[model samples]
Target: MRTTRNNNVAISCCSSSRNLVYKIKPLSHADSKRLLFKRIFGGEESCPSNLKEASTDILRKCGGLPLAINVTSSLLATRKTEQKWNEVRSRITSAEGIGSHMKHILSMSYFYLPLYLRSCLLYLTMFPEDYEVQKECLVHRWISEGFICGKDGEDLVELGDTYFYELVNRNLIEPVEVDYNGKASSCRVHDIMLDLLIDLSNGENFSSLLSNKANLARRIRRLSLMGNEDEGIIEQLDVSHARSLGVFRPTKQLPSLMKSDVLHVLDLSGCRGLENHHVRDIGRLVQLRYLNIHGTSINELPKKIGDLEYLETLYVDPGMIVLPESVSRLKRLTRLYVGTGTKLPDVIGNMENLQELRSINPFLQSTSFPEELGKLINLRKLGIHWRTSRSVGSSYKEKLVSSLCKLENFNLRTLNISFWLDEEDDFIRDFGFPRLNSVRTIRLWVGKFCWIAKCMLSHANLQDLGIMSGKIEQQDVETAGSISTLAEFGVFPACEGPVTITSRGFQQLQEFRFTWFNGLMFEAGAMPNLKELALTIPMYMLNYSESCFDFGIQHLASLATIHVQIDCRAVKAADVAALVCVLKSMAVAHPNRPALKMRTICEEDMLPDE
Candidate 1:
C-alpha cells in the first residue's frame, strides 16, 4: 500500500507481507547547517568566520529540510559576502510553515537567476516528474521557444548548452547522464524542486498543467495535460492565447487545433492514437516554430505541413511512409529528425537552414537525394541509411561518393553511415567514401571488415568508432590500432573467428568492446593504455583448450577493469567453473591485475544434457 503525506512525499509499504513502513523525517538544525556549509565550501572547516553567524540563521528557517539547505548553499556559493548571506537568511526566516519555507528557498534561487536562465528553468516544469530530459532535445526546444539568448559569433546551440549547465550548477536540476566529452546528455528535476516549479509556474502564469478538468486555467499560455482524464476539457477552454500545447500521455483523439492560430510549439510525441485526420488542420498554425509527432501512427504527413514557414524543428516517427515535398517550403527548419526507413523528399536541399538531419532513407537511384544533401552546407550532424542491392550500378556509387565529397567544407562533427546490404552484395569492396576530416565520431554499420580500415585511414582525427555486423580480420585490427587519436572502439562482428593483436597496437585506445567474437588473443604490448575491456562471447567458445585460451591480458599495463558476459544455455557447469578459475588466476598473477567481473546471460532454453 502507498499513501501521500504531502504532494512532495509518498510512503509505501507491503500489505501482503509484514507491514514494515519506513518514514523520512526532516534533518536537525545543526546537521542542516553542517551539510549546507560543507556543500558550499566542500568542507565545514573551510567555512568563513564572517558567514558562520548568517549560516545559522538560514539553517534555522530551512525547516530542517535537506533540499532547502542544499539549494540555499548552491545559491550562496556564487554570492560570497556576509551581507548577501544575511539577506538570504532574512528571507528564509520570514517564511511561515514547512511548505512555505521550501517555496521561499526555491523562489529565492529562482529569482536570483539571470533572465535568460529563469525562463529556461521554468520551462522544465512542463515535463512530468522524473522525466529524463535529453540535452539536445531540450536545447532545440529552447532555441525554438526564443528562450536561448544569442551571442555574437556563437552558435545558438552552444549558448543554450551554457544555460543548461548554469541551471545544473544552481541545484535547480540534477544531471542524469554526461557524455564522454563531459557534456550533460540528459537531466531530471528533483521532486522538491519540481513542486516549487509547479507553484511558481502557476503563480506567474508561465504554464498550466492539467491533470483533470478542474486544473485547467481559464487563460493559459502554455498547457500540458497529464493523461486522458481531462483530455476533453481542452475543447471547452478558450485556448486561443495558448502558445504551446503538449500531451504527456496517449488519448483517444487530439483536440482540434483550429483555434490555436498563434501557437509556437505543438508536441504530440508518443500519442499512439494520433491519426492523420487529427493533424489535417496543422498547416493553419503558421506561427508554429516547433512540432513533434514522433511515435504516432500517422503514416504520411499532410501536404499542408509546408505552410509552417517558421517551423524550426520537425521530428517524426519512423513509421511515416513519405514526407511531403511541401516540407521544402519550411525555410526556417534547422533540425529535422525522422525514424529509420523514412523516405525523404527530393527538395531537402532547399531547406538551407538545416543544421542536423538524421535517419534519412535515401534511394541510391534518386539523383536528387544525394545532390540536395550536398547543398546543406550548414549541416553539422548527418546520418544516412542506405539499402544496397547487387543491382545498384557503379555510377550510383560514384554519385553517392561525389555528393558526400561536397560536404567536406561543412565541418561536420558527427557522421553515421549505415548500409543494409543484400546477402550476396559486395558493396563494401567498391564503395568509395570521401574523406571527412572534421568528423570526431564515426559509426559504420557495413558488411565487410575492410570498411573499418578504410574509415580509420580516411579520418585520422576520429575519437570514437563503432563497427557493427562486419567481419574483423587481423589486418583490420592492425589498421584500427595505428590510428593515433582513436580512444574508444566497439565491434559487433558477423562471423565467429579468432582475432590476434600484435605488439604496439591501439596506442591511444582507452576502451575496447568485442561483441559475439569467437576468440581474442592479445600479444605483449598490445592495448598498453587500455583502461576498460568488455567481451561478450558464447559459452561454447570458452571450452577451448587451455593453450588456445591464453588472453595475454596481463600485457595491458594500464588495464583497470574487465567485464565478461557468457551466453549460457548449452554451457556445462564444469566448463563454466573451469573458465572462471582461469580468469581468477590471471587476475591474481598479473603485475597490474585488473578487477574482473563476470555474468551469465540465458540466451536460449537449456539443453537436455545440461
Candidate 2:
C-alpha cells in the first residue's frame, strides 16, 4: 500500500504480506491516534495536551502505517518541545509530491544514524525479513564482525546494547520480549526497514544474500544463505571473500572451506542436511570465532575442533558421542552450549576461558568433572540438570559442592539448577551452604521446596529467584519475602492449594509469577510494590463461580499489568470470555489503572456458550 496520488494516504505496507482472502483495511483514525500516542507517551492519556493536536496530525500524516507511525513517534519521543515536532511534521509533509513519503521518513531515520550504527543496521538485512534475531546472538555477532568495540575497562556487550537500543529508539529494529530486566531478549526488523537495508547493503557490497528471490553482487565479504535453495546456487556464487556465513535452513549447499579461508562466523544453527563432514574441517578455518550448529543433524564433532585457537563461542548438538578430548586446547573459547545427554570429556577444566556452560548434566559426568569445573575460575553462568535417576558417588558430590563453592567465591553471576527426582534428599536441601553475594539471579528447582531457600534468601545481592516446591508451608512464603534486595519472585510450590499472602510480606517485590494462580489469595496490603502479575491456571480444577475471581488483586498498591492464562481444554468459550471481562473490570477499577491481558493456553474441544 502506498500513499494515494493526492498524498493523503499515510501508510506504506504492513509488517508482512499474507495475501489474505479477505480484504484488509488501514487502521482507523482512532486506532492511529492510539498507536502514535502509545509509542511516544506509553499511552494516549499521557500525551501532553499541548502536543495532542500535533501528535494527531503527525499520526494522520503517518496514514495508519505502523512503520511510519513507529518512526514518527520514535523521532518525537526525543523531541521535548512543540517546535521540533512541528518541524518534523513539516519535513514529512513537504515530501508529499516529490517521492514516497514513507521512504523519506525511513531515510531520514537511517541517514541520521552514525557511521558505526549504520553498518550494524545493515548487518540485520542478512537475516530473512521478519526474522526475530536473538539479542545475545546479534550482539555477539556484532562484536565478532568488529561492528562495535569497547574502551579500557568497558564491557563490549553493554556497549553493543547501547547501539541496539539506539536503533530501537530510532525504530530501525523492533525490540521483543522485554523481560523483568527491562532488556529486550530479541528484536525484529520491520519488512519496510529491511527492504531499505538490503538495498543499501547491496549498493556498498557490504554483504550478500543467497535465496531464490535475491542475490547480492560477486564480492561477498559477508554472505547469508536462506531457505532450501537449489544446491546449484552454492556453486554459482563466489564465497572466497566471505568472512561470515549464516546458513539459515540451508540444504547442505555450504561452501567449501577452501573457498572461505578467513571465515570468522559459521552459523548453521538450524540448517537441514548438515552432516558431520561439513564441520569436520572447522579447525582449518583458523580465523573462526563463533561456530553454531545447535539444531543441525550433525551429531559427532570432529577432533579438529580443538585446533581453532581463536574460537570464542562454540555451539553444538551432539547425541551420545564423546566430545573431542582436544577441545581443552581451545583456551579462547568463552561460551559452550551442548545438547542434552551430550557428554563432555574429563578435560573440561582445561578450557579455562569458558565463561558460560549450560544444560550440562552434572550427574552424568565423571568424578574429574567437578575438579575440572572448579578450574573455570572465570565461569559466570552455569546450568545443571541433575536427574536423581543417575547414581553418583559421595566423593563426586563432595567435589561438585566444593567446585560450586569455589565459583561462589569468584565470578559466578547466575546459577541455574534443575532437579527432577521422585524421592527427596537432604543433599539437594544443602546445595547452598554459604551465601553467594556475587550472584544476581538464582533458579533452583527441586521436586519439593527445601529449607535451603531460607539460606538463599539471606544473599545480599540476589534480585531474582524462581523455584519449584512440592509442598511449601506458609513459613516458606514468609521467609522468601524477607529478602530486601529481591525484585522479581516466582514459586511453584504446587500440590498445595489456596495460600493467602498478607500485606506483611513482599513489600519490595515488583513482579510476581506463580504457576497455580487458582491457589493464591491477596490481602488488602499484599505486595505493595508489585506492578506485574502473571498467573497460569488450569481450568478443569475448579468450577467457575462469582467467588472464583475473589483473589483480591486490586489491593496491590502499585499493580499495573495483569497477565492471566487460562487452560481452555474442556472449558467453555463463554467462561473464558467471562473471565476476561471480570479481569478487565478489575483492572479498570484498580487505583493504578493496570492493563489486563488474557490468553487461553489450550483451546481444544472448547465448549460453546450454554
Candidate 3:
C-alpha cells in the first residue's frame, strides 16, 4: 500500500499493473505541457503562444500522464538532493577497500598529525604492527609519564575508550570492522604511515646513537644498544648522538649518553649487573620520554631521578634496591613497570598524570596497597603479581582479590599468574579473574583440585589457557561436566571423569585430550564432534578390563584423528575387534572423516613390572 499526499488517498499498488507503477505519482497531462514549456523557453518565458500549441501536439504523440496536474519546484529540489547524495556515497565507497579501513587505522598517527603526537606515535613502533592496542594499555602508558590528565570522577576503562576514539577521529587510527559486540577483530596501517614511523625512528637528520664500542657516541635519531653474553660481547658503546636509546644487556656497565640531551626512550631489560654508575648519568638526559629498567640490579635510585621530569615510561626491577623520595618529583612520568623486591612509594600514585602501571611482587606484598591507588583515575593496566604460598591463606588474601575486581573490565590481552598451593582445593575459592573477559590467553599455576577449573573453562573470551600441572577428580569432573562448551581450541593438563560425554554434549567439542585417566571404555556417545582425541591408559586397570573384548574406542562418528596409549598385552582380541567395529562405523557415517593411525604400548615393555 502506498500513501499519497494529494488528497487522503491510499493506493494498493501490489494488485496494479507493473507498467503503470512507474507512472503513479508524478504523471499527469497538464504537467507534461509545463515540462515542455520549461525545456523550450529555458525558464526565460520568451516562446510564442502559437509555437507552444505546436509543441503540445508533438507531446501528445509521446506517452502522456494518466492524470493532469500542475508542475511544482519542490519536486525538482528533491531530485537534485538525491543526485548530490549519490555522488557523496560513491566517494566514500571508493576510499575503502578490502581490509583497508582497519589497516589504515593502525597507523593513523603517521598522517597529518602534529610533530609531538607523531613523536609519541612512533614509540609504538616497538610492538608488532596490527597488534591490538588495548585502551587500558595505552592509558596506563600515558599515566606512567604524566601525559594524561586525571579527572575527579572518571572510569578508568571509559577514559581509555575515549582516548582511542579521539585518535581514530583524527585519522591517526582507523576504526576496526567489528561485530555488533564492538570487539576488534583485526586492523592494519597504511604503507605511508609506517614509513613515517620509520623516519621518526631513524631521526630526521643527525646520525643515530648506536655504538661500535663502549664510551663512544655517534649522531643518530633512534638508538638501540645491546650487551650480550656471547663470546664477542661489546662491553662499552657510545650513544651521544641518539635521541632515543633502548638497551638490552648481558653485561654490567651502562652505556654513557655522550652528546644527546633529548633521550626519549631508554630500556635496559635483563641488565642484572647494572650499578650506580649506569644510573648516575641518567639524570643528564632530562628530555627522556620513556625509560625501562626491567631486569637490572641497581638497588637504589639516585636523587637525580627527579631531573627527568619529562619521562613517560619507567621500568624498575627487583634489583633496584630502593626508590628515593625524589622519585615522586618526576611529575611527567606516566607508565611504570616494577619488578619484585622494589618498593613503590604511596606518593607515586599522587602524580595526577600517571596512567599505566605494571608491578610484580617482592614490592606489592611487602607493603599494604595504599588507598591512594584508587585516585589514579587515568590508570589503564594495573598489573600486579603477589606471592601466593600454601601457608599464606587468610582474609588478607581476599582483600587482595576484591581490590582488583573493579579493574577486571579493562582491555587486557594477556595475563600471567604464578602461584604455589600447598593445600588441596583452597586457592580456587579466593582466586578471582572474572573481569578479564577481554584476555585472549591466560597462564596460571595452581594446585590440583583447586575447584576453579570449572570457572576457567567457562571463561567466554579465553582462546588459550595453560595450566602447568593439576588434576581433576572424578567427582569434580562429573560436577563440571565434560567441558564440551569450551571453544574449538583449548589445552589443559590431564583430566579425570568417569562420566561419559553424551553425543549432544560432544557435538561442539572439536579438540580433546588428557593424560592419566581411568581405564574406562568410552561407549557410543563419548565424542561426536571430536576432530582430534588423545588419551593415556591407566596401568592398574589393565588386568581388570583385560578380559573385556576389543580394546579400541567406538561410536565417535566425527573422529578424524586419534592418539591413544593402550595396554594391549593383557587385553583380548575381542576388545580390539570392538574398537575396529567403531572405527568402521565412523568411516561409514562420515566418509570424509577418514581412519586414523593406531599406536599401542604393551605391559611387557614396562620397567621390571614396577
Give per-model TM-scores. Answer: 0.83, 0.85, 0.47
Report the C-alpha lDDT of model 3 over 1-610, residue by residue, as the tens digit. Answer: 4533323133345455544333344335576756644543544265554454434443343233211101111112222343532332232221243234322323232443544355445554443345454444444444433345548746444554555555554444445643223344333443344444544555443223233232224344555443332323333444555555555546665455745576666666666777667877678887777666666766667788788888766767666646776777778666667665566764665665666666554225433453445445555555555455544545655555554444344333334444444454364545544545534444445565444564455455554344456765545433333443443322245555443444444345555555534433456675566666655554445343433323334566666665555555555555644554554464445545554545557745443321
TM-score of model number 1: 0.83
TM-score of 2: 0.85
lDDT of 3 at 440: 43
What are the runs in model 1 whose C-alpha is more than 4 Å off? 1-12, 16-19, 24-49, 52-66, 94-100, 212-217, 421-431, 471-475, 494-610
Candidate 2: which stretches are off by over 4 Å?
1-66, 69-93, 96-99, 211-216, 250-252, 318-321, 386-391, 421-424, 607-610
Badly placed stretches (over 4 Å) of model 3 are 1-218, 226-241, 252-255, 271-273, 318-325, 362-370, 386-402, 405-419, 424-444, 451-465, 474-610
**If the candidates were sorted by their TM-score against the true structure, best first, what order would they fall in?**
2, 1, 3
lDDT tens readout by residue for model 2, 478-514: 7778887888888765645567888777788989988
